[model samples]
Target: MDERKIRVVVAKPGLDGHDRGAKVVARALRDAGMEVVYTGLRQTPEQIVETVLQEDADAVGISILSGAHTFYFTKIIGLLKEKDAGDIIVFGGGVIPDKDIPGLLEAGAGAVFGPGTPTSVCVEWLEKAVADKRAKEQ
Candidate 1:
């Protein structure tokens, strides 16, 4: 497997109009030599899952800043599992509260980055998560 060319799908789900962070993270991931497919904004969980399938992505990076992280994250994870797409590592960033992090992780999200997290941190964690998931699948 190509370690440096990790394929990622960056998605903005629900009515979250705040996309500045998503764009920045997408650019940073691209700069890190990862293939990034970004969904502009206002995407549904179904749409995001479809994008993942179409891209054949190894991981998904969701950006949620509309205080709807739990809702969207749970929905996406649930739908992904329902489709037997559990091999795809799910992670995200945004204004996520500390209290909700555990729930998100338990819901099949490999990681969650809160506000003030560096882009480099996300990039590193994403790579490791993808590698780990791939290892488990094998």
Candidate 2:
């Protein structure tokens, strides 16, 4: 609700060569009036976390299509907590199984979107999530 725009870091982690989904989501977030920083393709959890820190991002949205969502997501979340930056919201999408979603959330993902999720849904979720997070911090 403040004048400052919500900042989100969209990243592709691991050996995933495909980045179409990540790019789409990043553009959608930007179109929704959020400041989106795309970390490009094949990033490590450390690099993504460092970008989050440097950007002072309120949330991180990861796109993983290589079936390593659990490992990469948990690592990123762990690194965030280790660096005392657990307040940053983490969400993910791409090739994620329904059964894996609960585990992902338990591992610290705020939400996970599977195939066919609308961009508006993602934008709305980020808006509310960021607002709630900032409000709580205040």
Candidate 3:
């Protein structure tokens, strides 16, 4: 990984067994030159947060298809803040409703990718978010 590579943790939290989208997003981030760590399926919010800290990731990308994004996203955001990891850019992709996008952002999601959104879009968002985040930190 490049020293400047944006490290990201891609996770599927809770009982969400559908991971095709998560794996695809992970690959997209990797192809875009980010260092991606795929946490596989069935991660709890706690486990995801722990992995994020251990990896010292620049961002976290979650994919949920079990229709539990609101609960999980809020939980993850709370845990992240508790861990003092609120600086990490949090994003997600899945069958999320359009109305939920705004709320997710309010809850700390930097970006939320809906179904049919292209991989390039995700990459661009991550690239810009990581750059902007690092710039602000410095």
Candidate 4:
């Protein structure tokens, strides 16, 4: 496999104004040596998907606390499939209820982190996930 940094797009699904969690995770991912592109704030699902394709990102991490997690995740994942980019990993973190996790996963979210989960956990998982994905492509 070619030796290249894993690229990721971190987005705040355009609805909620709060992006503290998104910023924190973006910094952690960057610190972990991944190439991270943070889509400032209030990004529509369409914009986020566009960035992922433009960056050739291996994954996208969405930070949503707007109680719109299901809506955004389903829409983004569907859009990716429509774009024939379903192989791109879609993971996220935010204030989400436990009951909604399975539905999110079913909708094609690779994983979902809840509030207070350690950022290191996200980084480790993402690194492994992207590495595995790259290996499979090879």
Candidate 5:
């Protein structure tokens, strides 16, 4: 298999203005040798999915703190499915409650990171998930 750097789109979907975490995660992914495209703040689900398609991302990382994770994640996942891009892994992070983690996963999120999650953990997960996805594609 040809080795290729994983491509990821980091987006903030919703009205939330806090982006320190998103920027941090994006940087972390870049530092880990992955290509990271950050969509900035207040992006709608459609916009995020569009970015993913345009970037041909292997995965998407959404950072939300507006307490609307369920709605935003569900819509993003649904849009990806509709676009036949559901193979693009989706993960989330923010002030998500523990109780909502399961629902988020069930909604098609591969993983959820709560506040205080180490950037390395996110990087590690992406590395593994992207590798697994590539293996499956082959």
Candidate 6:
């Protein structure tokens, strides 16, 4: 993780049409010197996973405003595991309920940001998480 840039794919998954938060977070990550690919709205779990793999990202940040957080998270994580790409860290954001946080984590989300979470916070967390992941990989 030294000279190599931390690359991440930011996606909006499921029927969630809202993507303002995702774009803001993407910009913050880019501003923080990370490579960010923003996969726009209405992405299927399979598509997101494909983009992550194709981009060779260190992590993926999914933004979903729909009530289908459980389904999307489970499907994406399961797909990554199936593809033997479970090392790509998964994180999520949007209108998800607090009660669902633990379940999302169990489903393999590294973190979940609810409404009102600062983009800076997401950027900071992602930086540390990606760094830790890279360290472990070595």
- Candidate 1 lDDT, 1-138, residue by residue in tens: 745478999999998889989999999999998999999888999999999988999989999988899999899999888988978989998998899999999988889988888999999998888788777777
Candidate 6 ranges with C-alpha deviation above 4 Å: none
- Give me the displacement of residue 60 in model 1, in angstroms: 0.6
Which of the two, 1 or 5, has more TM-score?
Answer: 5
Any idea what lDDT model 4 has? 0.93
Determine the C-alpha RMSD for candidate 6 after optimal superposition of all C-alphas.
1.0
lDDT per residue for candidate 2 within 1-138, as digits (tens), equals 567899999999998988999999999999999999999987999999999999999999999998999999999999999999999999989999999999999999999999999999999998998889999988
Alpha carbon deviation, residue 67, candidate 5 (Å):
0.1
Q: What tens-digit string does per-residue lDDT give for candidate 4 at 4-42?
A: 998999999877988899999999999999999999988
lDDT of 3 at 83: 88
- lDDT string for model 3 (11-122, tens) is 9999989989998888988988888999988899999999999999999998998889999999999999998889998999899999988999999888998999999989
Model 3, runs deviating above 4 Å: 1-3
lDDT of each: 0.90, 0.94, 0.91, 0.93, 0.94, 0.91
Sliding window of 10 residues with minimal summed lDDT for model 3: 1-10
Q: Can you tell me which runs of candidate 5 are displaced by over 4 Å? A: none
- Candidate 2 residue runs with Cα over 4 Å from true position: none
Tens-place lDDT digits, model 5, residues 38-114: 99988999999999999999999999988999999999999999999999999989998899999999989999999
- Give the Å error, residue 63, model 3: 0.3
Q: Model 6's lDDT to the true fold?
A: 0.91
**Model 1 Cα displacement at 12 (Å)?**
0.4
State the lDDT at 90 in candidate 5.
Answer: 99
* RMSD to truth, every model: 1.3, 0.7, 1.8, 1.0, 0.8, 1.0
Model 3, residue 113: C-alpha shift (Å): 0.6
> What pairs collide in candidate 1?
none
